[model samples]
Target: MLKERVINETVPIQKIYDEEIMKAHFSSETLPSVPLVYKIQPGSNQARKNLTPTLPSSSSFDIPDAYQSTNSDETFLIYDKLVSCKKRVLIFASPK
Candidate 1:
């Protein structure tokens, strides 16, 4: 006589549906509401003094001879040279 063979196998898996679960847990009607308000105080009449003291009203302000230069006219000349040079490239970078 021939004997029959039998096989049994099982595989288990768990999946989480985040959107459906969140939708069931949270709703607009269940959330709490709070009112927000802000108020500003009035300033006092006392005048604030500068941290760095200013020069006397009678004294005339003058730039130091060493720091002054005729570079203002040369700025356009340098710009023109940069424009003429095809190999040159200008790039400006700023955080803002």
Candidate 2:
């Protein structure tokens, strides 16, 4: 039998934060002034539901041109993608 994370009411208890990690991330000079941390989640449907699709400006929506790949010196590590909050990822705010 496969183990599964059951969320009856979706009470998130696990924390994904570390102090030393944050210190290193914030100190990086090459990083952007305002870091763009994309909220990646389990559901693939969320992006399709929340955001409308847009065609590339270089190409027409009806055109089927082979996408040209550009080489870059930039490198992104798993550590760079990570984020640490003061506490667990708990959104206490609610809408009326």
Which predicted model would earn the best TM-score?
Answer: 2
**lDDT, candidate 1, residue 94?**
29
Writing each residue's lDDT as its tens digit, candidate 2 over 1-96 gives: 000211211222121212223545665665456323232223322433344345545322332111111123222111111134322221222122
Q: Candidate 1, 90: how far from true, in Å?
A: 1.1
Where does model 2 exceed 4 Å of error?
1-28, 33-35, 39-96
Worst 10 residues of 2 by lDDT: 1-10
lDDT of 1 by residue, 40-86 (tens): 10111111122224553532333332223232322221221234433
* Residue-level lDDT for 72 in candidate 2: 34
Steric overlap count per candidate = 0, 0
**Clash count, predicted structure 2:** 0
With candidate 1 superimposed using the best TM-score fit, by how many Å does residue 26's alpha carbon deviate from the native?
A: 15
Model 1: how far is 5 from its true place, Å? 68
Report the error of model 1 at residue 24, Å.
20
